[model samples]
Target: MEIKEHIIQGVRIAELHSDNMLLGSVEEAVDLLGNMYYNQADAMVLYTEHIADAFFDLKTKVAGEILQKFSNYRMKLAIVGDFKQVSSKSLQDFIRESNKGRLIYFAETLEEALAQLVR
Candidate 1:
């Protein structure tokens, strides 16, 4: 896992780049938060493609659980990538709701995610 930090509009966002699936468990979520916190990042940006499929499966509830961790720790999370490939209406709805919030967002690109952070 490689974490690159970017400061956009005065907010520090850590962009996580990893070949491994980053969201396999709640423990992994904690680790991610740790990394971001250690880096003094105000927010985290993850490419959707780096996440595991299990994270999005509603039955598993990994997505909610992981996101809750971020919320609990008072960290912002931005997921970026082409979400059109994911064909779940419920997931789409969940993303929509999440995007409405200040802490969590689903964006099409890193630039878009950074834009949301500035807002």
Candidate 2:
């Protein structure tokens, strides 16, 4: 797993990347949050582009788990991507509702995700 941190418009956003499945289960999701907290990031923008191509079946579950973990830690999360490609309506609804909350968001672009985090 590779976690990179960046400050955009004063918001600390960490971009996480991994060849391994980052969130195959709830425990792994918790571990990722621990890493993010240790890094002292206010929000995370996980770059799953590579993983998405490699492990498509796990995407929604992984994303949902991350959001759940962040909520438990009182941390914030924003996934930047074009989510329309995801064929699951349930996941789409999950994304929509998560975005309505203060801690979770699904943004179409990194800029928008950064803006959401900063606000």
lDDT of each: 0.87, 0.72
lDDT (tens digit, per residue) of candidate 1 on 56-96: 88789998899899999989988998887779999999989
**Ten contiguous residues with the weakest lDDT in model 1:** 16-25
* Model 1 / residue 12 / CA error / Å: 0.6
- lDDT for each residue of candidate 2 in 12-59, tens digit (9 for 90 to 100): 888777776565556766877888888988888765563344223444
TM-score of each: 0.93, 0.75
C-alpha RMSD values across all candidates? 1.1, 3.4
> Model 2: what TM-score?
0.75
Maximum-TM-score candidate:
1
Off by over 4 Å in 1: none
